[model samples]
Target: MPELENNFYNKNLKPLARNMRNDSTKAEIRLWCEILSGKRMLGYGFRRQRPVGNYIADFLCKELMLIVEVDGYSHNFKMEEDVKRDAQLQALGFTTLRFSDREVMQDIENVWRTLEFWIFEGENSLS
Candidate 1:
């Protein structure tokens, strides 16, 4: 994977990304505050609503080249679009993990465990 450069961040999307950060959904807020904020997830730093390429990722850990998305009801109608977007991100060297809003809101511990396990596996692969 190539190193992320300034060009990887779409400057045109900055305002939209900022708006998303400020107007985060309840699930997004919970995920960020409880699990991902302040390098809390195995000390991996995550940025919310970070602009990457042409899209703004919900949560991005640049070091891991990972993006986590909290999909709401609307996402059910956009599965194909989501899949394409994930593929595009993957092409850019990112691994995207997605969770439904209900999973994040009602079963937060599971979400945390899933993320922890993924990180653990990734670290082991490096070894």
Candidate 2:
């Protein structure tokens, strides 16, 4: 049935994998998991490379419309592309936040604090 197939397809949309193999995105993910384990994270789950519109975002919480990007050395070569994608996401009512790999790895606590505050700010603004 078409309905059954649709349901099955939706169920298969697993955003992130737990045990990352050769992903260069692992460091940011590990730091995020540590932050999440500490209850520093809010409604947004750490979704690795979630596809939104035509862009594949690093981490996106669909419910909150919040996108988190952990920029690495590679991103330096794609600033213009990133900016265009970010503009499209913003137009779709999503707020994008970016943190560098060094920032997340060397200053994790601050990253957590900033992420928490942003999430809370989103919540508070809604009411």
Instruction: Kindly list the per-residue Cα lDDT of model 2 for residues 10-106, writing each as its tens digit.
Output: 3323343222322646556666577643444764555555556666666666657778888889889999998998898897778899989998888
lDDT of 1 by residue, 35-104 (tens): 9999999999999999998899999998998999999999999999999999999988899999999999
Pick out the ten consecutive residues of candidate 1 with the lowest summed lDDT.
1-10
> Which residue runs does candidate 2 get wrong by more than 4 Å?
1-24, 36-40
Question: Lowest-lDDT window of 10 residues in candidate 2?
Answer: 4-13
True-vs-predicted CA distance for residue 76, candidate 2, Å = 1.8
Supply every candidate's count of residue pairs whose N, Cα or C atoms clash at under 3 angstroms.
0, 0
lDDT of each: 0.94, 0.69
Q: Please, what is the TM-score per model?
A: 0.96, 0.73
In angstroms, the error of model 2 at 96 is 0.7
